[model samples]
Target: MLKVDGLTKKFGELVAVNSLNFEVKEGQIYGIAGPNGAGKSTVYNLITGNYRYEGRIEFDGQDITGLPPYRIAKKGIARTFQVPEIFPSLNVQETIRVGSRFGARGGLDKKHSDEVLNFVGLEEERLQHAGLLNLLGKKKLMVGAALATKPKILMLDEPMAGSNAGEIADLMDLIKKINQQLGITVIIIEHFMKVLTELTETLLIIESGRMICCDRPEIVTSDPRVIESYLGDSYAEDK
Candidate 1:
């Protein structure tokens, strides 16, 4: 559904993302993993039009490399940040409505917004202020707002961060349902290997903005170079 070829981004002398190439199939959960400052988030920034990149990015067969961020969002791509972001003053329902209004080409749909709130398991909290919610609630709200945009592909950055085991399970189930039931393509950037193995079909590993490997989770995780460079010798032994 989305293809990136030779995508490179540099800030002065520092090459944040270098010649990164990958593809995300429709209705698939594609995972990206790398250590901190490995240009993982920078790739997303380049794809979403936050930076001027030296490469090609195509979605549904059209080039979107130099488009502005809002234009990219309008082109059926929506993303959630590593940190939960929402309007602190707005109620849950109102926050989602803002997304719907901005993202929907035809304007906001109140019924659809309400359904999105319920879909993210925030129905009862719809009228509550967004800042009053706990971490998990805020995260769910962030996902719900992104869903409200009606994106064909959803890119999530560290969606499981700061969650307990049960909350992680809940979010994982929700992500699976969003992919399997809703039929939206998913691109997730996460640190947890188990989560990637369980949820993603294709896993892309990168370091210093270069591809280490790209294959099925099982194959990529078992790769000797991948184990040595990213997963470490200890994780390799456990395998």
Candidate 2:
């Protein structure tokens, strides 16, 4: 559904993302992993048109390399940041309504907004202020807002970053529902290897903005170079 070739993003003398190439198939859950500052988020920035990149990005067969972020979002691509982004003052339902109005293709749908709130498991908190929610609640709200956009492909950046084991499991289940039940393609960037192996069909490993390996999760984790550069010898030994 999405293709990237020779993707390079440079900031002054530092090359954040260098010649990265990968593809995300429709209705598939793809995962990306690397150490911190490996340009993982930068790739998302480029694909979402937040940066001027020196490469080609095609979604559904059309080039979207230089398009504005809003334009890209309008084209069935939605993303959630590493940190939870929510309106502190707005109630859960109101915040979701805002997304429905602005993010939805055909504009606001009140019925859909209510359904999304319920989908994210925030139905009881619909009238509660967003700021009053806990970490997991806030994260759910963020994902719900993204879903309100009605995207064909959803990109999640560290969705389980600050969650406990139980919360992680909950988020994982939600992700599966989003992909399996809702039929939306997913691209996730996470540090947790087990999460990637269990949820993603294909995993792409990168370091210093270059592709290390792109293959099945089990295969990529076993790659010698991948272990040396990112997964480390401990991960290899664990297996």
Q: Which ten residues in a row have the lowest lDDT in candidate 1?
A: 100-109
Which candidate achieves the best lDDT against the true structure? 2
The global Cα lDDT (0 to 1) of model 2 is 0.93
lDDT of each: 0.93, 0.93
Candidate 2, which segments miss by more than 4 Å at Cα? none
lDDT of 1 by residue, 1-239 (tens): 89999999999999989998899999899999988889999998988999898999999989888999988988889999999998999999999999898787677989989999989999999899999999999999999988898899999999999998999999999999999888999999999899999999999999999999999999999999888888899998887
TM-score of candidate 2 to 2 decimals: 0.98
Task: Please give each candidate's TM-score.
Answer: 0.98, 0.98
